[model samples]
Target: MRLLASSLLLLCLSAYSEGTVISKEPGESIHLTCSSEECPTYSNEYHYLYLYYTIDEEAEVVFSNIKSERFSPRGKYESRTKLDIHNRTITLSNLTASDTGIYKCVYKKSSTEKITCSVYAVFITEKTPCSTVSPAVEPSPVLMYIIFVCIISVLAMWILMLLILPKVQQRFIKRRAMHAHQSSADNVYEIMRREEGAQVAAPIGLV
Candidate 1:
């Protein structure tokens, strides 16, 4: 009986000393068991169970058993943690990278008797979100100014052509009309000179 009890104690102590590593992504949940099996049952009045997490060598209490069946959570875990005494587990939800650490449960059976349960080394990996929206690029003021200048120049050239084309056409038509009148006058004068020459030459021959 004595040997059997000592072996059982050794087994329990070995189980407590063993460590477990748990890995998860951010915003996920994890269940941390205090012991491999159900935690040693104790009277409600004498039971004092607390869960703690350590990060960057700093430890803080996560779950605290107030009295018999009452419990309280501290700090950032006020709403994200759920403690199940019946299952001897603590479920931490909505995990983040800052929550990566070592977690352990401590049970104070009496004033001088305390038991620390299994330790969990938790690792929370943060995934960066991919962006599909393209960044807004501002229009270059110099480019815009150049485009505006080009448009204005084209419009100015078109308006200038519209104003000058009718004047050019009128000048061309007037020059054509003057040249036609000069040609007609020259043709009539040449015919009159030829008729006078013929009359003078013929009358002299007849006389």
Candidate 2:
């Protein structure tokens, strides 16, 4: 049993030895490189670079060079996937847990057995030691300036609104009261005119 397990482990390690291994956090972007001149894979004279993702030996092809003669690539990967045949590279952004798996890069001259080059790709999301991780990037001065300007604008607007809004509201209320009083006076004057007209016409009416 121990011998079998040891052999299996070694086999698994050997299975992933062909190409580069990358590790990244979720939602991060990654760029993968494939060389046509690279050893063993030789990978030369290919028209397109196809990326396959899987857990088993066989993988689900996720992205391909659309402009390739033999293949136009699949539709679902168009949003966050990109491939370059000239540079022999692939880039994927905004990765998720679903993306964590074995990825393979294949260079295809055509769909035929005449030429197909493949290399294994391994990725891990498990927490790596700090030494392996890239250093945290510092905020740029332009970004800091923009943030500072935004904060200042917000605080200035807030203070101006706080100081001026109440005075404007008070003035509005006074104008409304004045208009109401004018309306009431107009109504009273209309009634008085009516009463005076009635008294002058009848002379028998007491107002």
Candidate 3:
């Protein structure tokens, strides 16, 4: 019994020591393996695998074979995460600006046995046209001066119209009143001549 217990302890230690990592770029897949050289049954007991990513002082379990638990992701790593249990691989697809970081794999043999390994990954995202260069564009001095001159011209025209329009209207009204008074005086003189002709014709008829 004492020899059997010692053999079991050695088997467990050997199983924990066996781990391999495959490096991959962003938007690619990475495989992690935990197996034992001595015991075939111990190597096959891969119950679950947990994949974690860390960027900008934040760490999160992005993928896991055990699906019922809640996993929290920080920074811009809340999405674009996946895991495959049959092949022991984690795939981060459609990577973006925030996928550049260190990624780790944790293998869980059972409720108690666990092992971990980590690798560094980098993602080079394309920059926009505005962010790539510096020195912001400024409007030309000639354009600014032209705009100022246009505004001043428009204001001066408005002020001139406001000052001249009322005086012109008053002058036109006075001319119309003078013309009407002259027409009335001419009609009165014609009526007086007709009355004088009627009186002279009546005296000739009596004679």
Candidate 4:
């Protein structure tokens, strides 16, 4: 009988050390387990279990054993929360972005012993596309200045061409007139030299 009692006590101690609360995502159910092995004259009598949640600096009691299905919330959380003591689980439906927080489970037994466990619940928050809706992505002032400079350069080149074309045409006309005058003077000098040579040949023949 003593050996049996010793074995049962060891088993109960091992089970009491195994209570745990698992971390879960928001909008999903989480199970908290409090178990003990068979022991003589020791019935598992839990007085109450409290579930608490803190979200964004607001604290609230999510579940309690006194009211099985009557866990209340401040606002916008009346119908979205549920607690089941039979399964030691808490279910939150249609979780929103504001549901991300820490959850703690406290269990009180009739023997005045308390067991506590904690888990983190994370809710996904949808963020807007920052790259598409920003006004800072407009065209830079440097790019606009570069475009203006290019336009000014093109206009300056066009004006320079207009100013140089008339001077080039006048230079070409003067060169052509000077060439014609020189050719006419050379032709008159050649005719006079030819007449002198003819007179000299006629005199030699007469001698």
Candidate 5:
């Protein structure tokens, strides 16, 4: 029995010591949780629950269960503080040094008058280094393949035109010369035939 009790006490200590120590800049937000399986449920009504914080040994109210649709967050909050009553947590946005301290959650079970509490400690630092992330992606092979095919097709067309155009032009010039020579030879033969006919018909006896 004593051993069991010792183990339980150690577990509780571990749970208390394992809380987050938020260290963030003034412009950043700090989240603190008072979460445990044994944590109490939030009150549906304003009369049964209260949340507080202790700063410089002075207790300051943080939230009270209220009828106006949300936690009645208090004192320097002014939209800078957020409370999650159901989760037993608080988030302080746009934090300043004055916002650092111990925070608590208090829930009262009305029928039996039972009270449950959870606490968390917060610490704020002056600054931290900036962080950035860049994603890496593999270049697609399809674009490379398309570019390769286009370059080869253009080169092949250029080579074909360079090698074949001069040959085609030379063949055309030779055909034109052959046609001109044949026409000149036909004209000379017609002139000869006409002179022979005229001579035979006119003066055979005198010659």
Candidate 6:
């Protein structure tokens, strides 16, 4: 009995040596395969196949399947895993850093005898931080058109001011000259009237 138990333990330990390492980043998915070759009696007999993994060194059952029947995923793995009994595969999706551990596929023949058919060491890498500086984006055509319109409007206003200012100044100068000529003529007429009045007063004094 001791020899049989020791051989079974040795066989289970040997299964770990043939494990493959799967590396993935967060939010990604991975498929772990367990074909009939891994569990020889899988195709011949209708036994229970279980997907197990370690969490903090404790074994946790992820999925359980029996031949053609539907498999049930346990705990939080219910939403993250999909089991295909026909293909003998289990897919874990939306992976996170916490999912890094040793995953095992076991063939359970009896309550006392369980064989590890395949093993997988899953490693979820940490996400790299994004750069702080954003890439330079080209200005949109609508924005460029608005800027061009604003520049043209300012230039048109300046040109209108330059053309109108000289004409306004010329009109002001012509009005001032006419006002000065009228004032000079009025002053000359007043001086002549005063001189004639003075001459008439002197002749009356002599008479």
Residue 182 error, candidate 6, Å: 99
Q: Candidate order by lDDT, highest to lowest?
A: 6, 1, 5, 2, 4, 3
Order the candidates by TM-score, highest first — what do you get? 6, 1, 5, 2, 4, 3
TM agreement with the true structure for every prediction: 0.48, 0.42, 0.34, 0.36, 0.42, 0.51
Tens digits of per-residue lDDT for model 4 on 69-141?
A: 3444435555765665555556666664345444556665644676666443332333336578644333235
Q: Write the per-residue lDDT of candidate 3 for residues 1-207, one digit (tens) a residue.
A: 323332332333223224332233345533333222321232556445556664334465454444343343344545655444444445555564344334556656777886665443432223326556654444335333433444555568677789787788889999999999999999999999999999989989999
lDDT of 5 by residue, 33-126 (tens): 6455545544333245555665335565565553343665667775777776555567778877555555665655565664545665554434
| Every candidate's CA RMSD | 36.7, 20.1, 32.2, 36.0, 31.0, 33.3
Model 6 CA deviation exceeding 4 Å by range: 1-18, 130-207
Quote the lDDT for 59 in model 1.
Answer: 60
Best by TM-score: 6
Whose lDDT is greatest here? 6
Tens digits of per-residue lDDT, candidate 1, 13-126, equal 233335776767889999988755435555534377778885324565564553556777778888898878776678999998567656888777676877777777675644
Question: Global lDDT of each model?
Answer: 0.67, 0.56, 0.49, 0.50, 0.56, 0.68
What's the residue-level lDDT of 70 in candidate 5? 62
- Each model's total of backbone clashes: 0, 0, 0, 0, 1, 0
Tens digits of per-residue lDDT for model 6, 1-207: 323332332333234335776778899999988774657565556377788886335566564656556688887788888877677788999998567666888777677777776787675654545776455444435334433544555668678789888889999999999999999999999999999999989989999
- The weakest ten consecutive residues by lDDT in model 3 span 33-42
Which consecutive 10 residues in model 4 have the weakest lDDT in total?
Answer: 33-42
lDDT of 4 at 177: 93
